[model samples]
Target chain A: MTPESNPILIGSQRVRVELIDRPIDRRPLSDFIRDPDTGAQAWFEGVTRRMTGSQQTDRLEYEAFTPMATRQLQELAAQAMDAFSLTAVAITHRLGVVPIGEASILIGCSAAHRKGPLAALPWLMDQIKADVAIWKREHFAGGQSQWVHPQ
Target chain B: MNCQVLLFAAARDLANSERIDVEVPPPVTAAAVLDGLGRQVPRLLPLLPACRLAVDQAFVPADFPVSAGSELALIPPVSGG
Candidate 1:
């Protein structure tokens, strides 16, 4: 119901992470926003982009070392919760070949005020990119593909 | 003893094999298994530094002991959402 009602686990505890070839559910946005106590529910969804600067992208493929990736992501979420005092936080990352405009990562954080979740969202994303055991391959229209390294 | 090492993501793709059974001397450590893996799958050399090892879905440190019949997986850096 409310973000406060759904408290996320914190610390070096266990968390759930799965790798599926199917599409991700977009309902979490509405679910997280339905909280009455949440003064701000900030969400960031990473979708496959069709272009990057002057380069036109055809599609993208994602791969992950599931165990390590899951562990890292859980750690990030836990840290964010402690640092920001977030009410609810959910992150779902899709694997495999995701076409253009499809969601890759869905990050939601709800807090009593806008600043906490707002600040935590970008920080969490940066941590995920820096530490998580995930990699991406960008496929161009000319049948060339390159592994996208972490920035 | 021989234990199967499961590979995932880039490790799996580079090794060209999903799983490999590595034989080692008694009382092996996670590090030893990784050493054996390096010899078995030379392509994994570049990935070892960034790779992490897990036993039955739980991440373990390199010095951790490897029991007989344990299931180990070599997890390369992931690129998921």
Candidate 2:
């Protein structure tokens, strides 16, 4: 499914999850998950770093099984919301080539207290890295490229 | 039964193709298709044991029953930010 076709559901709270082919914007996502009653909000941005195991990376090419990746991401958001008692949660991960210093993934959550959002962000990130149907190929400056796999 | 297995990431690179079709005997299973893939593309054998299998978008075990028209994918250990 395309990015625009992605859904944002609302019931007890809002949950937005998407797989985009462009850059990730943190502010809009942060605002999307904001709630009037929320006492705190947490935002996490994952950027493409320039180094990997002594190799200098110029950029990263991300590929995803779009349909499955989108489904997994939505499931992750729902799990985070339920597990952490979050009022709102949003996750957006970028596809295609991402240059060093560019944000490749954005995760935001809101809760009535700080601890919930704080703990959920990292947990969600780990889940995304481990379970999501996405892959990254690091392109090094020396014309070498390698696929990165989760440990 | 005939089935197609989709490859991704390292599995894709190793197989040198996006998808592979295999014909199996009755009582088809994900493991059967994976075995056929290993025979057709020897390079995929090293990654097969570690890779996960997904049938119609959900992860399934190696012995999970598969049908002729099922959508399958080989998911290597993922690394996403």
Candidate 3:
């Protein structure tokens, strides 16, 4: 398959952001920001689950307003890097169909001290959920589906 | 002039298309775009109140002037992590 449309869209010396259409493997994500000066690397993975409040999810499909999402993600990474004094930060969000147990989003942050990455991880996640232009449609068992609107 | 408003998530489902082209008058504002969509795609209007408008990949106020060539998107409340 041609991965042309889903390659890493933004990157710099300390920041990388991607809107990918495939599964997010956490191995490389953890290693992405690690280096000799890095004393702490914080990682987060958002996985697709089979259940959400008693509904049996068969799968989850992700969609994004690609241009906006990409730009926003890049901004988030940069902001996190600056705010947390991070050595590097990486984020990958998936698009299209994702099976249960697969990761839909991955975030990694590395810093010279533990507090920097640790403090930045959750804050960045919350910001992404609040600001990014991405959505998830949950396909339920027995052929029903619904868009996940936050309450 | 005509400008296309891109739809996403719930808005896309309501409109039944990824985008809708609206015929707008001169000095097209975000309000005018939504008004046009309400007339053309009535199904999309109910959700418009909860959504935000993005012009050229950036969020803007309802009074923001949007050119025909600008990329417009209707942003529903996000659910990404």
Candidate 4:
């Protein structure tokens, strides 16, 4: 079953932030960001790559300090909306073991113009990587797993 | 004073437990809790400096007072994209 979550509204944007234990559906956010006046909608989906340098990664395990992470994500969404003048944002990250080629994260953004949505999507992702309290462990083909984090 | 030290990710791996209770002098501080934790689990000593301390879900400074029964999470470097 999909992990439990609720939509959050900040400013004019309806943000979907969740720490799910199952696969993330891209459709919901796509539908949420639909707008006739909005000329640009940018979506980003991060998937588990099969290879990491010379090592082949079979899967990735994710864990989260949920409450703090959720709080930080909401702050990020609100900041993104204010910073880039975005109309909507939706983000979902997966927990538990995710096999190769599956979506580990999904970020969607919409704006009245292309510039705001385009700029906000990638910036939002970078902020999540740097600030969120989530972790990733890569399981290699040699049956060894390594915990990965940013310096 | 007593506070619950919660471990996550690499900190959890190093300590081999998700939670550890620590006792400190009156008016416990986050640094004292870290010192106490390092003393109890020597393996955590090297990693403690890099870990971020959060009390009751808010990240706090080393000198931040840890209230009784509060949960302190040790958040190591994060890489979530």
Candidate 5:
């Protein structure tokens, strides 16, 4: 399905997962706010780095099976909330070309304690790496590019 | 009947197309669909064994029975964080 037709796969107002074509603003740590009762906020960002183990990368191109990706993302977000006893969680992933230093994927979670938020963010990232349908292609400085896949 | 299998990323570049349609007989299992695709596009055969089949937007095993006209996609090992 097209991005416009991509459904908002939300478990609730507290859990938000979305795929955006444009750049993501990490300033707000996504649209998730630190409500009055929430005592901690944790964020994890997957940025396009210039060096990927020595191969200089100029940018990254991300492609996703939108329908399935969004669905899985929503499921992951909801699970993170329950497992971590979180107040809110938001995940935003970028699609298309992303220049170096831009955040390609960002996740933010709010919880009652620092430990929960800190623990949950890394766990959530692992799930995305294992199951998410999005793919990342690295464009090297020499103009060569290749998709990142299983070894 | 025939079903279309959507391709993506490295698989897409290898197949040289966004999708491929294959003739699948009755009792359309995920394996049957992959076999059909491999016969039609030999280039994609290498990736079939390593890939998972997504039927109607959900991951299914090779023997999983798929209904006619359900959307199918070849999902390679993903790398995202």
Candidate 6:
């Protein structure tokens, strides 16, 4: 099935979880909003950072147990769709080594009213971090790297 | 019965072997396989606390049963976005 047919909104969106190595398009957000006849589409893009606390970070690497991870992410999206009155949702995440200032995750949601999608955006992000099977490894400037868990 | 156990991520890198053959009694459970693995590959003991197991590509908790010819994978903590 196409991404539009099974659009992912909150949990690790379709683009991020299924298309791990491909680049994501921003147009999906606009398209979803248009299709839903909504007045507003709230979007959030999580970018890689150059610094972590006092230490300078070189890059971030991500690895996943592909099959199980994808299943878990899809389940999350379905849950969000049922909980919130959403018209359409799009989510994308990048795997492998992501450089600083690059988008790692993109989430968009459309609803009849602005308040629902707006409030649900952050809540969805939190659920993704907490329940998703993805993991993040931070590489420091001095060649030290550490795995970071969702908090 | 002899079955092959697959390792991934940090556990694979540490063991230096993708698959190992272990002998177990018939109708073994996933937990029993892990116990046998620890005895055969002592190095895996330290990493067990942080690892998970999968059967036939699905995550199975310790109590899950194992059948002969089942594919088992040792999954370390994942680090993906």
Q: In terms of TM-score, which candidate is strongest?
A: 2
TM-score for each model = 0.77, 0.93, 0.91, 0.92, 0.92, 0.74
Better of 1 and 3 by TM-score: 3
Badly placed stretches (over 4 Å) of model 4 are A1-4, A9-13
Question: Per-model C-alpha lDDT, please?
Answer: 0.73, 0.85, 0.83, 0.84, 0.84, 0.68
Cα interface RMSD of each candidate: 3.4, 1.0, 1.1, 1.0, 1.1, 3.5
User: Across residues B1-81, which tens digit of lDDT does each residue of candidate 5 receive?
Assistant: 788999988889998999988898877899898888889889987777878889988899889998877999989888776
Of candidates 4 and 1, the better by lDDT: 4
In candidate 2, what are the lDDT values of residues B1-81, reduced to their tens digit? Answer: 777889888988987899988777767887787788888889988788778889999998778999767798989889888
Residues B1-81 of candidate 6: C-alpha lDDT, one tens digit per residue: 787988755566568897888886756887888888888889988877666677877778787888877888776665444
Model 2: DockQ vs. true structure: 0.85
DockQ for all candidate structures vs. native: 0.35, 0.85, 0.82, 0.82, 0.79, 0.36
iRMS of candidate 1, Å: 3.4
| Candidate 6 structure quality by residue, lDDT tens digits, A24-137 | 567765564555367667888888889778999998876655555566766655666567776666666767778888877787777777887787678778776654556677
Judged by DockQ cut-offs, the docking class of candidate 6 is acceptable
What digit string (tens of lDDT, one per residue) describes model 1 on residues A1-151?
A: 1011122344443222334556777575447444678788788989999988878789988776665566677777777877998776777787778899998888887778999989997898888876576778899987887777542
Q: lDDT value for candidate 4?
A: 0.84
Between prediction 1 and prediction 6, which has the larger DockQ? 6
Q: Rank the models by DockQ, top first.
A: 2, 3, 4, 5, 6, 1
Best by lDDT: 2
What lDDT tens digits, residue by residue, belong to model 3 across residues A1-151?
A: 2121243534555777778777776766666677898888888888899988888999998888887888888888888888889998888898888899999988889999999999998998898898898889999997999887674
Q: What CA RMSD would candidate 4 show?
A: 2.0
Total residue pair clashes for candidate 5:
0
Candidate 3's interface RMSD, please? 1.1
Candidate 1, pairs of clashing residues: A63-B79, A64-B78, A133-B78, A134-B78, A134-B79, A135-B78, A135-B79
Worst 10 residues of 6 chain A by lDDT: A1-10
